[model samples]
Target chain A: DTAVSQTPKYLVTQMGNDKSIKCEQNLGHDTMYWYKQDSKKFLKIMFSYNNKELIINETVPNRFSPKSPDKAHLNLHINSLELGDSAVYFCASSQEASGRTDTQYFGPGTRLTVL
Target chain B: AQSVAQPEDQVNVAEGNPLTVKCTYSVSGNPYLFWYVQYPNRGLQFLLKYITGDNLVKGSYGFEAEFNKSQTSFHLKKPSALVSDSALYFCAAKTGANNLFFGTGTRLTVIP
Candidate 1:
């Protein structure tokens, strides 16, 4: 059983196009997160949702929006994708939202290529 | 503010030799540190964490880390490295808000 999973493993789109990546976790976790890994392999958190409520919103651009329909799912939608958006997106989940000690599990990741 | 640093960009080791990947952290309050490993084309995998227990923490795949409060470091170590252990390693610090700050990853190459 995959604890965390992300759909559309690879996304290739033209500049200014819009795309969405889906994430789901069966770990029964209360918190979900989205992270971006740049070409240099620098990982940074973008957004987090706890029980379908926005909790952590980093200094990300407004073009990127995260939506959580339910506690088990979190999706990221990128509008006007630019070349800078070409990177890997990871989805993660934790057992609780308030526990700083809780371990997070990550999904396979979606590789986005904005041409 | 919370931050993690991995000084080494890459470390090469031979099979059967011990390996160490250094990590340091800076945070406001008590530091909650974590180690994650990533293979090519894969997501980050949890290796270990230091909350408030023993300074020496053991983790998956024969890995361990020592947490030093004075030094503000959590360095991952392995007694004997295997070629399969070659991968990218990351150190992270969790903040009071449950946000994680990751360091620039260190690539470990375990040569056969």
Candidate 2:
């Protein structure tokens, strides 16, 4: 069984277009996170949700929004996608929201190409 | 503020040889360190982590890491590297806020 899964493995859209990536985890983790990996392979956390509550919000632009309908699902929606948005987005989940020892499992990532 | 650093951007090793990827961290209290690997066009996979207890922690796929508090480092090591072991390795440190800070990542290449 896939512990964490992401839909729309690839997304290509023009500037000003909007797109959304869906994520679901069967690990029964309460905390979910969205991360962006740039072309330089630099990974950075964008947002984190715990029990459907927003916990960590980085310095990301307002164009990107993350929504968690339930504890097992977290989705990312980007508005007015730009060329800079061309990168891989990863979704992860941890068993506990504040448990420092919990390991976070990641999904297969979504490659977004903004042309 | 918490941060992790991977000194080597790339490391090449021969197949069947032992390999090590260096990682250092800067955090306030006891550090919560983790190692993750990423294959081409794939998401990050948890390799191992060091929260407490033993200084040496073992993980998946014959991987292990040593946590040295004095040096503030947690380096990943493998006894015998395979060609499939080539991937991008990342070191991350978790903060008190329950957020993780990842390094720039180190690309490992195992030559046959």
Candidate 3:
């Protein structure tokens, strides 16, 4: 079974358009994260939600907003996307426990292209 | 802040030869290091991790990593490279936080 999944594997849209990428996880994890990989293959964390609470917010622009409706879903909505926003976005989830660490299971990622 | 670095952009090896992918990290507290592999057109898959104890850690697909605290490095290694092992490998680290910082990935190409 797929542990973590993202919708719309590929998205091509014009500049200044708005788009949303959906992510869901069935691993019963409490922490979900979003990462953006640029053309240089530098993957950086954009945001993280633990149990539906915003935890880690990187230096991402306010144009990118992440909304977690519940523990199982975390959706990213970009407003006024720019040409520089073209990259692959990945969703990952992990369960956190005291004094124990877990590996993050990633989704198939959504490749976004802003023309 | 915590960060991970993968110096080599790409590492090439023969199918029968051994392989190594170097990774280094910087963190204030103890580090939680992990290695992940991403095949073409696929998501990143977990390979192994070093949370505590056992300086040398073994993972899936006959891969292993040595966590050198003195050098602050966690390098991935494989006994024998396979053509199917060609992929992008990433090193990540976390320090007392739920967020993981990933390094610029290193591409591994095993020549047959």
Candidate 4:
């Protein structure tokens, strides 16, 4: 069984376009996170949700919003996508109590290209 | 703020040669270090971690990392390199709030 999964492996769109990347996990985890890896290969945490509750929101812009409808899903939506927003986004999940701690299982990333 | 550093952007090694990728971190209180590997067009895979006890931690694919508290360094090392090992490696640290900060990845190219 796949622990974590994300939709739309590759996305290419023009500027000013709005898009959404969906993520899901079947590991029965409580904590889910989103990370962005830029072209320079610098990966940074963007958001983390614990049991459908927002826990950490980094210095991400207001244009980017993360929605967690439930414990097993975390979706990222970006408005007015700019060239600078082009990067690979990853979704990960971890168990909170005994199933998860400091260790997170990642999903196959979704690459977004803003032209 | 907690941070992790990978000094080398890329490292090259022969197939049979030993390889080392250096990483350092800064965090308050005890630190939890982790290493992950990412191949082309793939998500990162967790390799190993250091939470408590045993400075030397072994991970998948015959990979191991040594944690040096004095230097705040956690260097990944392998006795021998394989051509299939070519990938980008990231070093991450959990310093505070149980948050993970990843280093600028190090690309390892094992030449045949």
Clashes found in each candidate (C-alpha, N, C closer than 3 A):
0, 0, 0, 1
How many clashes would you count in candidate 4?
Answer: 1
**What DockQ results do all the predictions give, each relative to the true complex?**
0.82, 0.81, 0.66, 0.56
Name the candidate that leads on DockQ: 1
Which candidate leads in lDDT? Answer: 1
TM-score of chain A of each: 0.95, 0.95, 0.92, 0.91
Residue pair clashes in candidate 1: none
Give the per-residue lDDT digits (tens) of candidate 2, residues A1-115: 9999999999989999989999999988889999999999999989888864686565799999988888889999999999999999999999876787888899999999998
Interface CA RMSD of each prediction in angstroms:
1.0, 1.1, 2.3, 3.1
Clashing pairs in 3: none
Tens digit of lDDT per residue, candidate 1, span A20-58?
999999999999999999999999999888864686565
Q: Estimate, for each residue in A1-115, the C-alpha lDDT of model 3 and write its tens digit.
A: 9999999999999999999999999999888889999988888889877763676565899999988888899999999999999999999988852224778899999999999
TM-score winner: 1
TM-score of every candidate relative to the true structure: 0.97, 0.96, 0.95, 0.95
Quality of candidate 2's docking, in CAPRI categories? Answer: high
TM-score of the A chain in candidate 4?
Answer: 0.91
Candidate 4 regions exceeding 4 Å error are A97-101
Between candidates 1 and 2, the DockQ winner: 1
Residue-level lDDT tens digits of model 4 in B1-112 = 7789999999999999999999999888888899999999999999999887999999999999999999999999999999999999999987545657799999999999
Ranking by lDDT: 1, 2, 3, 4
Writing each residue's lDDT as its tens digit, candidate 1 over B12-93 gives: 9999999999999988999889999999999999999999979999999999999999999999999999999999999999
